[model samples]
Target: MSKSKILGSTLIIAGTTIGAGMLALPLASAGIGFSTSLLIMAVLWAVMAYTALIMIELHQHADSSATLHTLAKQILGKKGKWLASFAMLFLFYSLCAAYIAGGGAQFGDRLAQWFGVEVSATQGVVIFTMLVAGVVTIGTSTVDKVNRLLFTLKLIAMASVLMFLAPNVTQSYLLSMPLQQGLIVASIPVIFTSFGFHGSIPAIVRYLDGDTPSLRKAIVIGSAIPLIIYVFWQVVTLGVVNQSTLLENQGLSALIGTLSSTVSESNLAGTIGIFADLALLTSFLGVSLGLFEFLGDTLKKNSANRSQALNRSITGLITFLPPMCFALFYPQGFIMALGYAAIALAILAIFLPIVMVSKTRKLTTDVAYRVKGGHIGLATCFTCGVVIVCAQLLISAGVLPALG
Candidate 1:
């Protein structure tokens, strides 16, 4: 991969990872406290990076032309492929739903504030979902261009918020100890939400011309950017917002509102809101495109050449409908749903790669970029799988803190 390709791939990965969730990081990190959250974030980053490295290695060893589904099929056989496909489908759909819901809530709030109208959140979601679907109906290339633009805008908005909020930070906030009970469990969703870029790995690997070195660099550098951003945002948010405010609000907009009250300008709050809407929109579109591509490929392979219209319609419906319903009915629950999706994605994007590489050990050559501490690396991957499964159970049982 050339430097420009590396840069492009990094932007795609970072953009995909940094959506909607970053807005919620402060609230998510508050329960664990700042220092503890930072430590947890660091550990999660290392784990995610290692898993991503393993994924690249697996991709290198497998048929370069294979999609993620086929990759799973090759290793875990039909059962594994079914599991991986189901998990990924569920994960991406739920995530798209969250994005739609989040975008709708933000759009409605902003619209209501601006126009003095009583627009419900559901109405907002419907309007935005139509907009996204219409744009996607045009072409995939348009969505790609939009993702790049949104990535740039998201970075600017985030940078501005950080800079605007930085002076308000106090040393005491950074050094505070975390609350004891449920902190470990609470950190699960936050970590899961932050390190989510698994959906794009195969496309990224293929985009780099299937070169192992390029794929490794893209995953490492691409993932690192978001981790750094998450940590920085967590620190700034922790310093500015108190625990009481966080617990009471449990949403990103509310947290920003509280933080902005301490600053001299209200414009920063408005800017953050607008930027968040863009970020969520970008995320929704990116994931939606990926889902469509996956569906399209599956249909073409299974149905032969006669199912073009049927394929397109089914793809559109699958990509749009569930998310649209969730957006309309459960707009407020978007962030929590996103956390759930992230956990599922971690399984497909992180755990399945390790399993694939382990099963296809014959395909891996001595020259490939292998993970260090071979058996230990495999052990760590297994531990992450167990942790993710347990975390999912706790989250489902309502035992973890519900941070937006």
Candidate 2:
């Protein structure tokens, strides 16, 4: 692969990984403090990156055009394929709901601030979902081009926010201890979801034409971009904003509001809001596009005789409806949706990759590239996935502290 293709693949992975999910990072980590958050993020990043390489390994055993669905079917049999399909749908829907919840609140807040129009959460959800669904309906080429533009603007906005907020950092805030250590468990679900570019691995494999060196580099470097970004984001947000302020402002809207109010500089505050909005928009575009495409393919497989327009109409409805309702009914569910996404992601990204790779290894030794660490590495990744799922369960059961 040429450097340009490598770069494009790298950016795709990075773009897919960093999304509206990160907006909830500070809120989730606040109860655990900055040090622990950094440690956990690092561990999750390592696990995710390793599993991504494992995915590439699985791809080498299958056809170049094979997706996770096909890989699971071929290596792990029909049962695995069904599980993968279910997990994928669960993951995509959870993420779409999260972005919808977050984006609607951000749009509504923006409307009230910019035009003095008080849009309700339901109205914002409708507007936001419609706008994104319209773009998705236009198809992938349009979405890809638009995503690139938005991704660039998002990076610029993030840079501006980080620079502006740097001077406001308080050493004491960064050094603070966890308010309740058990909340650290609750943070796992959201944090793991933050590194969710595993869905793009098969595409990356095809894009790079299964060049092991290129795939490994793209997986490692692409994933590292988000890790570094998250570190800086944690530093700026946690260093400047008080733990109490972080804990008090729970939802995405409240988090953005807290950032704006905590900062003294109006320009910096405005940049922070813009960055948050961009994060949500870009994430929604990427995630909703994935769901739209998935639903389209599914509809075609079931009803190949249907007209394209009719198929698209059904696909669009399936893609946007449930998530829109979730956002409208639970407007403050940005973090909640993300936590659920983490569970499904653990199954899709972590567990399946580990299982498929292990099965492939047992079946054949002829592999272009294999992720290192053998069974021990696979066990470690599986353990991490279990931990994430259980964390969400414990949080739901009130066994773990859900607060920041």
Candidate 3:
């Protein structure tokens, strides 16, 4: 692959990881404070980045065309294939629902403010789904072009917001301690979600023709971009807004409204809005494209006689409809959806990678590039994933505290 394609694939990974989850960071980390959030983000980034390399390592032995499903069946057997399939669908659908819920709310607000037209959340969900679904149905090339354009705009808007908001940072706020116990534990699942670009690994592997050197570089650099962006984001957001204010903003819409109202620069508020919308849309396109292709492949197996165009259309509907309905009924499901996405991500990014890598290493010795740390490394990563899964479950069961 050429340098240009490498860069493009890198951007795809960064774009997918940095979307709706970024908006939830300040809110999720509010109770945990700035310093602790930084630590969690760093650890998760290391773990996730290592697992991504494990995935690339697996592809070294398998075909470039091999996806998570194919790899699971090849190495871990039928049960592993079923588990991998379920986790992929669950993770992708949960994320799609989140972006839809958050994106629709932002889209409706933009319309109401700019055109003086009132659009309900349900209507906004329909409009948002239709627009992105069209691009996805057209296929990956179209999604790539659209994602690049929006991702560029997202970066610019983010930089503009950071510049405008930097002067408002308070040292006292940055130094604040965790609001209550167990909040750090609760924030784990969401923090883990922010580093989730593992779903794009197989696609990246194929895009780079499974070139080990290039794939390794792409995964490391691509995942790192979001980590740096997220750290700076935490510093600026947590510094500008205190825990009390963050706690009061319950949902994405409320958080955006609060930021706009609290800031003195009118233009700053508008830029923040632009950044938020772009972030949501870019993330939406990356995720929906993956889900659309997965669904199309699954449908093709059952209906091989269907025309390609018709198959794509059906896949698009399956990809968006259930999530659209969920978004409409639960408009505030943005953060909650992300929490659930983390659970599925743990299974995909953490559990599957470790188990498959271990099994494959024992079964064959044809590996060119292997992740270090041996059995200890795999064991530690597995434990961390289990902790994240249990944390989310505990939070859901009311045994652990949740973010405001």
C-alpha lDDT score of every prediction, in listed order: 0.75, 0.87, 0.88
Error of 3 at 91 (Å): 0.9
Predicted structure 2: clash tally: 1
Please provide the root mean square deviation of candidate 3 (C-alpha atoms, Å): 2.1
- What stretches of model 2 exceed 4 Å from their correct place? none
For candidate 3, the per-residue lDDT at 30 reads 87
Compute the lDDT of residue 84 as modeled in candidate 3: 97
**Candidate 3: 10-residue stretch with minimal lDDT:** 259-268
> What ordering of candidates by lDDT runs from best to worst?
3, 2, 1
Residue lDDT tens for model 3, 173-221: 8988997779999999988999998877888888899998888888889
Each model's RMSD to truth, in Å?
A: 2.5, 1.5, 2.1
Steric clash pairs (candidate 3):
none
What is the alpha-carbon lDDT of model 1 when measured against the actual structure? 0.75
* Candidates sorted by TM-score, best first: 2, 3, 1
Q: Per-residue lDDT of 281-367 in model 2, one digit per residue for the tens?
A: 988888888888887887898887888888888899999999999988888888888899898899988989888887778889977
Off by over 4 Å in 1: 264-266, 299-314, 362-367
